[model samples]
Target: MIFGSERQQHKILRKNHQMEEGSSHEITSPLLSNKEEELEDEKNEEDVVEIDENENSPIKQVALTVPTTDDPSLPVLTFRMWVLGTLSCVLLSFLNQFFWYRTEPLTITAISAQIAVVPLGQLMAAKITTRTFFRGTRWEFTLNPGPFNVKEHVLITIFANSGAGTVYAIHVVTAVKVFYQKHISFFVSLLVIFTTQVLGFGWAGIFRRYLVEPAAMWWPANLVQVSLFRALHEKEKRTKGSLTRSQFFVVAFLCSFAYYVFPGYLFQMLTSLSWICWIFPHNVLAQQLGSGLYGLGIGAVGLDWSAISSYLGSPLASPWFATANVAAGFVFVMYVLTPLCYWLNVYDAKTFPIFSDDLFKSNGQIYNITEIIDSNFHLDYAAYERQGKLHLSTFFAMTYGVGFAALTATIVHVGLFHGREIWEQSKSSFKEKTMDIHTKLMSRYKQVPEWWFVCILIATIAITIFTCEYYNDQLQLPWWGVLLACGIAIFFTLPIGIITAITNQTPGLNIITEYIIGYIYPGYPVANMCFKVYGYISMTQAITFLQDFKLGHYMKIPPRTMFMAQVVGTFIAGFVYLGTAWWLMETIPDICKDTSSVWTCPSDTVFYDASVIWGLIGPRRIFGDLGTYSKVNWFFLGGAIAPFLVYVAAKAFPQQEWIRLINMPVLIGATGMMPPATTVNYTSWIIAGFFSGFVVYRYRPEWWQRHNYVLSGALDAGLAFMGVLLYLCLGLEDVSINWWGNDLDGCPLAHCPTKKGFAVEGCPIFT
Candidate 1:
């Protein structure tokens, strides 16, 4: 609402300035020149955004104000603009969903929204909405508490609703339900998303002063936000030239309705294009040749890996760095550990070395691999089932082991390494000076706070408990377990996240977490569920923090407002995300014989939140007879820990210089650990980081310092709009090319692999 209202205020200001300035240009020139000269003199005397310890900090005088009834009409949109922006976001959201949904039956996955595309549409809409409706009327938009304001609601909703990151969240919940034939109610899903999921936002705020502000830390995604704000507000400042604002309420209503219906039907027509499929498929050629585009595809496919990748590349870097650490994980799990069992000839690798679902059977029936290994080696399948997925006790032991070593190593390195810059930033003068630019920015926009997020968390938790009790009382675990999972996840994940954020990388954590869940909950769903919840919450929070931090990079909203906006966004999103998630789960069953179809089901093991739960917590429950000494755990653990080692290595020998070269921990981890076949993640990372880094580091200019976010904003906006069209045209139908695998014949777009052994197919969208 603040965003929308701001547009209106900006319009009035511009109109008044234009009218008055136009009438007296000749007479006012001398006076204006004198004033300009005086301001120039002041700039020389003191930096525009600089701090002065001798005087009260420039920001101290500025106070936050709320909207009052005096300008009630002024604060609201004229109905049209509000409708248009809202409609645009909704259309984009739905289109994103249709494009990514796989139409195949017999595939045990559900069709869910393309999480990434929604954000792009929102990003695009942020600019379009602001520019089209609020350009000169920023002040007219109210920041006061009241019923929904179009501007704020649109921005927050877009921020909240857009992005495939939610898929990971849904996947977790879906996996658990599918595994046990249990469903999480909409309320439970909301509880999981809003409460525990957003706690990381608070933690992110705690570190905001350090990551953002003077450090000028770059979070590219926020550039989109900053761009939108500046573009809309620039007219008031007279930094850019002129356009009338769109009729607010008119466009808003239209766009919202258009968004809702277009994706429902129109997407079927758009997805028939050939170019999309030629560029993004699952084959090796597509994987290798189009990997760069694959990352772009993420944007179009409605998977917001860019945000996550950006976060990992800089501020919240764990998962990305996990890419680098994955190599070590592979070495330890596959090469070092699994081989030990094979050396003893426990099981015949020559016959069945590569892992398969039925390792001990010739066909579907069981066999005697265990018998042969009994005399020389032993594996406890019974013990495996009893323990279920990796348990918490195991996670605790490993985390302690890893954290103990990492913390000691990191502290020593920090003392020896970045101690000076840290010291400099701590100085009152420096802090004050740095805080000044942001202080001036505070008067520019609406403010939200940390407490709002806290409240949202509480409310979400309450809702989840109520939902769980109502839907599946028998499957419920103690609330403490959930809380404990969140607590441990938050503590353990922060440093890793921070490291990744700075380095623009992430060390893998999924495997380790899975193994841990297997150890703690054992045979119950409790451990698995907790692990999934914690994993999604931790990662999403870290990413969101980075996003907010990036927003701060350009604008000067107090840490409080940024936090509050996030809460507002999250609270709003929680219900929408859950409602859609439940709708898909509930509605998809009747359309296709295979409820697991990626297009029809809401719970695909690969893409759903439940995947993590299943892999980490339910795998052992379902397939525990698999050996822990197998190469999987060893390699997986190695990948998870690589970044810690890299960090230590970087700190210990600053001169070695290779450390700086290898900043992309996630990239390295991916290349090193994931079988080379899985290069999609790395390729995507490289492509994304390349453009972002180029824009921020090489292209940044000294002038227009306050408005540097425009480029990024424009790019994201353009891409998002294009992405909407992409999904609309080709995303809704079962029309992808078949190469490696396919769905059942009767099912839409379903085909079995032709035995060419899984590779990318070009004609997926067109065929």
Candidate 2:
């Protein structure tokens, strides 16, 4: 052995002693403290290389993203395919729209069809044959051409997917009748809803080459479906002492199915348990800070996987790098900043509850929105001023501030990072310069040319114009505004579509459109919504369509077949949703009114409230330079600047690849998911994120890759199954189970924040 000199040996020993001391300190420190956790997180992050985007990362375990480029030979558009797909489409359409009017609307995923339709499809495939069932002079037809293959399954799923998204325009019509006490003829309502809901498809078809064909444009969310399909169809061979994919999937699905029961039902308290709230049960501050259901969950923990996975998506899906930035911002804003601002009475926040999305009066009562609006659906400024400005929770206000920031951040981040690539790709794709495996395979099939999309786009625009012309008094929209809305949607489609394709999120143009319409058509509430919906939802719908297009491309389904399924599915969805909306309105008395026995149309109420706030009252009265919350407007500029700062840092320290970890859009986008999620969701989301993306990926690499998405799918399926069962068997039947034991997850202390003796109505919550 080579021995160093005495001096060199002393230097080595000293270095060892210093490392031992640092290790001791880190291990000895309490992990429960927020400061300690923050430090630990920073250190842990420094050790990680790439997240889900890096294929080598254990977090992205699915080795096979897209299966081999074989011929997609099986039938894609058989007679049975349309029949089954349309039936499933109508069923989902009916159920989704049926639930949209509920206090807490239940949304079922298309995973139901993904799993359930396999057997029925196979059965039909086995029984039916290509032996001419129907014969015409020109053509002979069959119910089945071959076994129900992946193409058939994919097409069926596509049919069911059309009704997956909530029809936003129905809310507008429902709000007019149920909340605002105004009436629209059924024909006009159906036309408005149908046009707005499906108009984006035209734009989606137009941008397919730019957004759908590229290999790098991986929509991470879509991979779950791809994985599921591969598992069901692509047979896997296993060696001795190894678990086959099927065996692993079965075990995972069963485990998730069993575990979800506790958090999902029966002992619901397990869903959210704040030790702080338990320790200081009587302390209002603790409850305000810790409870999950009512307050911002500062020190709360939830056991429900579904609740944890809300809004942000499965922890298995988000990369740790993005997760870290979001958690950092979420904790800083929700836990630290919001509390300081509320305690110090920023924006007179101390006058209202510390946490709520609802608007409040000076006396801490719910704002009487009807009293402030005129018969024409525009704001009565004189009445509003007399009633005083509407107030929001400190957290809610911050969400808006962050929403504005996120909006601009999305724009700037994409432009800075992907703009050049997009430009280069644009030139190539248009000239037919680039082709990947999926695109090449797709080329063998006859393409749906650009003119098909153009014709549909022109026709829809014509219909929209005709509707506006005929219902000018009701719609309050000029022909120019209609054109302008579609133009804005078309202009932003390519950029947002590209972003969605890569990030699995579309940076919405909702705020931008609302701001534009508020300024341009300030007094016309209906026109403002029309403009906002056309500008925003159209783009969103376009993204959804393009996402499906890419999914079909990856699966090797024919473009023309996809075109048929989507068009037919969309029409069915529109009809079904319209019928459901009309049926519920007519059947239920005072349909949108708050009722303990039935759904009160919470989604519609929110839609109505937003319309009143943005369309009727306008942004100038809320977020302008002279508005009550004028300080928040600065976030717009701040949002734009944040990405530039990150860019500069990346440029300066180019070797510190970890510098890419600072994602402004992800951070800001996460903070703004207000309606569907609250503080509890984000806190639990971060906890799950670190576990899935860090600990499991690093230590349990095999399980991480094999069962992560499978487990997520199982959990989602289980929760959906349970939710529907409970709703049908208990909720609709009004099976009363009233007791302290049956109280909502959080009670008494939660939602009861003490601020100068709090009151929501005439009574003080503290008392």
Candidate 3:
């Protein structure tokens, strides 16, 4: 078995209006729970999770749960564990990177590992019994070491999750060659990807004391995965009146698998239905409001469960209080706020498409940045002067301002709310008995050294500096600019990590790095991208790595062993993701343009546009005094204060329990998630959320416990199973069955735009 591995995966979040778009990969981080009774009181704050909700009780737990791993002695670093983890890592990495270039940019989570590793492990266990397979030879060893246990399963998941998506740097790598026509060496791309990812390990390794060691820093998402593992491996007597978890999981899995065929392949229109679009096919306003796939959904609904759950999360796992917060914020912002502004023609938005992030000329045509960008990828002042300024849709402009507010609000919110606690936790790291039982158990094992991460950070930094400095055509970044990028990541990691560790949401560094670096490294588009990948991706990678660290701690895997697996796995994934991107680029024709083709680089277009705005033209040129949308900059101040006021309100009016649930970061942060996603997603997600969190948890407690997370795993598995089957059977033949029978799920007019006279370039492309 290999002792060390590096893992890297990619997930691109979509940005609309000012930001890029939502996530490139839908992160299936599973939900909240704990076994400690004293921690039940910790549920008072929804933002702060301390325990899992009681399984037998009728309510959802406000805090994250801490469950004990059943077995600690089982050898986690074994022949079978190594083989399975590595294989799954490579395959999923390939799969995600392949889909990453598509117009829709669909990708699955390492939750697939949770589903696949088990059955495969069980099969291997059955075939490789201790006495039979390696019976006579001293050289032979049994791959099956006792019943396949929780630790092995968990280590496998960590490996998969680490390598699940393309490393964030791939977007920068892809855009340089594909969008900017800059050539890059294989080594340069690989080194950049590896450095952007591994550099974060230093921060994660250091912060483990604060984020992973504390009992209160429960990673709420891991609880769902924990519950599923228990349901599968642990034996419990079946109640006479209730369906067993296995039984419910089986039923839900098959049903979901069968239903997916319709919306996923056969009847695509089943994804969304907009009666308004059908009734008023030629009306641009009706199209804008009712086109489920193309516009904001007005009186729209989706039949596909995946589409419903895509934006938020699985309804079964999300607690109602959290769900309600997401729902209320999504609605009030997207439906009420966005529509009102657009109708009022805010920003003279009526002249442009209702929703888009693509820069456009003031005259309502897609703003061609090539005209403004010179051959060296620098902004041409004369060309820019001639073109005037770009125009953003009303909703798009609104999101930018809101995004500014969200960034500052998160910093202020964390400082006011969790600053004192973080300081104390740092103190508690050296003090005995201050840590949780999980931490105590983990402390017994040999830990990975801070020096290892330090070595990684120093090495990757050297490689990156060389890449940026020597390869100016591709990177356009100075050596000091590299340092500044890293500095931004280091500065934000603690606060952002604190936030995600408590509440699963991460207020990303993407918007800020682009905004700030745009100002500093003005006119150097590639430098802006380099800054973003290093600053934003590095921090996110650190936090995610910390999440896995906490996971290994919970499962009681040796820290050193876990570290080795990730180091090896991430390195392999870097190769795999790069290869897949290269393959797609080489094969796909008319990519990033022909949306009708699967290869259209919808997400990368956002990436290109962002570089043009923040990197090429610079923020000073766009949002500064010379810009048309200068008022949006005031949001920095507004965001900084909003969270402070929210905290004061919660503290001042202590009686208003509802005020405590109003997480300012999440509410404002959601505005940024809009675009490239429709109102139907919000509608469907909220519906599922209320059903599971409110109805099922409240009305049928027993049912919720036996099946919630288990069912989620099964549904994911079933959908995947069917997808594989369909693709192999028909997709390999390059046959996508297209028909008008169930077109847009009975809403042909759904894409009709309501407004007339003005040509909204790219208006055809809905959110």
Candidate 4:
């Protein structure tokens, strides 16, 4: 297949300049002068050659960030790599799963492990003996072949990336056991986790040529890691007034570590500084507008880096153009649409809290989900009818509509903007002439055999079918459901992968998968959850695997080695994730409940709510003919049409290059994380994005290039380390200081309804 083809075709013109008349070494001058001049000229020539080679690629970001050269001699799969890489994977997996049940889940990215392993790798290289084993044999190896190098570091980071985030399948297990309070065997859960995690490897292998090798599919997020790798490894001279990159990283890391104590533990109010709520503490309307944790958060902002980057991600890594699109979308949704709808009482919005993800009755009381679930774990039709139609908070319903729009927008956007290019790429994928420099360099290493992926794909599918069918009483999903889920995952992997490859934003399949299976098999919550995991998370895992492959490609690591590392790391992470989660569930009392905020599983709560609404209750009762919010389905058409309009506008106004950059998918999907992500998250994320992406990148290009990504990595590493320390030292013991400063959400009235005569406790009833 054609690997690494560029979208934009640009030529770099070369110019050869003759040496100036007096600048050439003079015979009369000292021989030392001539030698110095000669060396300087050689260095200048080398710089020009490097620039020209890099510029040959059409994508500007790739040309700027990735290095043009490669060192094949550097050992990648060394003894140190296995030791450090495996350890990093296991530790990160355990830590991430451990933190996933918290009030604000801290996702410790691979960047932290990337930074932490450098010292350990070097220490091993320094201390271990270099004596070779099995001398004169083809299988000879040594404890330390050489000093720690960048290649080994990249592989370890990839290994860590495999386990950086909590395993998606674990959510299924949590939803079934803790939320549903059902008895599920650990073997079934393990099978589900391993199968779901590995199932995506098939999709990744099939689409690697399109997603990983394309020069135009730059995968912008990888640039941050690439920049960090260069900063940590490349030697640099400290400028006259500025600190060296390493020195700056150290200073930033320490400051970030020290500052997290306020928002993380001691003064938790710093996480969401809703000063407006503080001024009018008793005013429901005022608190609703000002609260950062709930409501619209009109005037809210955060001081905590975790609150900013938790859901939205580090804004420093996003490109200026993409960030601007996301900012516009957030404002349109949170500021304009939400306020207008809630005040107008769209879908009886004011009957419930202005912003909530919880299911409710018509009178604003929380829905009793257990009442509608029968002994068979199916929907009790009589109980559901007695409870009447379920209702959602206005913001929650609107978010679903937006999700519908975003999914279609993604497909339409790709078809309109990238259709022709994709078609052409498919037609000429096998042509070797289309390969870019990175691809050419990678070609030297033996390519992974297609049969390996085929074997994995077949085996994973077989195991999944066996698990579902053999354990049908517990799983409730039939063998056919597994095949259908795989089909959906494989079908969307290409389009979704393209969007993620280009934009750093991934449009999720959670809603679509849940809706499809909910309609197809309505009564079983576990079945719907399992279907969503297999269909949605498999695609997610594929995209993640492709992202790592792109990182490996940029670092010039061998494909086979990359494959091996990912497979091993994924298996290790799956076991660790399951173990940690099981331990926490067993040890913690009242976990995933209101009694303990520290272990109140936010994401899992949302997942369980979804199971009730879509599975136990079924969409036919909520969004179908019998549902009150049926009109929201019109968003599908709106989403489809929105991108076409953008496409027409870009064509009609070709001179306005900015029109082409208006991404509808990103714009519509911008608020996808809203229920879980509050106002402070988006507001703080936007501010950081604007300052770093636009301000620094526009006015101070040199400084932005030198320090921006390094700063991002440092902040992440510091927060991760400090968060773990706090949890271990204080959180586990429930040793918290109770005071105003420790109050995370200062707006007590934010969750209260403003509707007339609501009669809810803790709020003044409107008369």
Top candidate when judged by lDDT against the true structure = 4
Q: State each candidate's clash count.
A: 139, 0, 54, 2
Model 4, position 253, has a per-residue lDDT of: 92
Model 2 agreement with the true structure over 1-767: per-residue lDDT tens digits: 22433233323433432342232211111112355334333432111111112221122222235542333325577877887898889888888888777654566667666777878887887787658754774676677675667788889888888987777778767877777777677898888877886788789877777787777776666766776675666445565676655567667666766775555456656667666676777777777777776777767777777667656677766657767877877877777878888888888786766777677776667788888878776678789888887777777778778778887887898788878987897778658664554565577689998889888888888999999888987888889899999988888787677656654545668777877888777766778878888888888888878878877887889989998888888888888988999898888887877566457765566566667767777788778754678888898999899889998999999998987767787777666666546667788888888998788878987666656666666666666677667767766777655443344445356555466656654324554
- Model 2 clashing residue pairs (backbone): none
lDDT measured at residue 566 in model 4 versus the true structure, 0 to 100: 89
Question: TM-score for model 4?
Answer: 0.93
**TM-score-better candidate, 1 vs 2:** 2
Q: Rate the local accuracy (lDDT) of all candidates.
A: 0.37, 0.71, 0.71, 0.84
Model with the higher TM-score, candidate 1 or 3: 3
For every candidate structure, what is the RMSD over all alpha carbons to the true structure, in angstroms? 12.5, 13.4, 10.1, 6.1
> Would you estimate the TM-scores of all the predictions?
0.55, 0.87, 0.87, 0.93
* lDDT (C-alpha) at residue 177 in model 1: 52
- Tens-place lDDT per residue, model 4, 99-184, is 89988898899989999999899899889998999999998999887779899999999999988966988888888878888887
Q: What tens digits encode model 1's per-residue C-alpha lDDT throughout 209-276?
A: 44554432343333334334333322232223422111221233244335433322333222112233
Specify the highest-TM-score model's number. Answer: 4
lDDT for position 568 in model 4: 96
